[model samples]
Target: MNDKVKALLSILESAGFSHDDLAGTVAELNDAVNDGKSTSIQLVSPGAAARYIKRINDENVFTARFRHSDEPDLLNNESNDERIENPNQDSCIVVSYDPAKQ
Candidate 1:
């Protein structure tokens, strides 16, 4: 894997994010990079990645796939499961638009 990917994955893992969480986080970060929201081609470093991940997670920036319903049966249902939270929650992954480049 590339340095950016490795760094990002390591950072996420250290911040209590599971492998699946890292996967989604990487996807979102890639999208940001592709969209020109972020200028850097790769994650700065494992330290930088860790800091960013912690910053985002602290901001409670996460998205989930399922919604909870107010039903006693559903609460007890075995099929009920928490949604897979999205990596782009609460603007955790920050993208600062540099006007100097404009």
Candidate 2:
């Protein structure tokens, strides 16, 4: 899977958020004038995604995911141990402004 998909799946798996729990998920993004809305079924709630990313970032499990071979940073003798410190900006998903996918 792509990094975003993998990262999210890892978060969900780690958080014990099963596929059933995703039924209530809404990809929302609220701003000063709008109450946020659903952008797509293929996306996750930006707020929730950011929160989980941050929470999991501190966990050792997430640290291993970052160093996994599929990512663009590792090899025989070198590695990048950078962590996900900014979930809001680091997440591949985009927030919405439409306020409703309904």
Top candidate (lDDT): 1
Find the 10 residues in a row with the least total lDDT in model 1.
Answer: 63-72
Per-candidate TM equals 0.33, 0.25
lDDT per residue, candidate 2, 10-62, as tens digits? 56555455656553432221121133322322232333454554554454222
- Model 1 lDDT per residue over 1-102, tens place: 444445545645665556764565477655654455533221223223435544433432221112223211222242434432443221233323222343
- Model 2: lDDT of residue 48: 44
lDDT of 1: 0.39
Q: Which pairs in model 2 have colliding backbones?
A: 36-99, 37-99
The Cα local distance difference test for each model comes to 0.39, 0.35
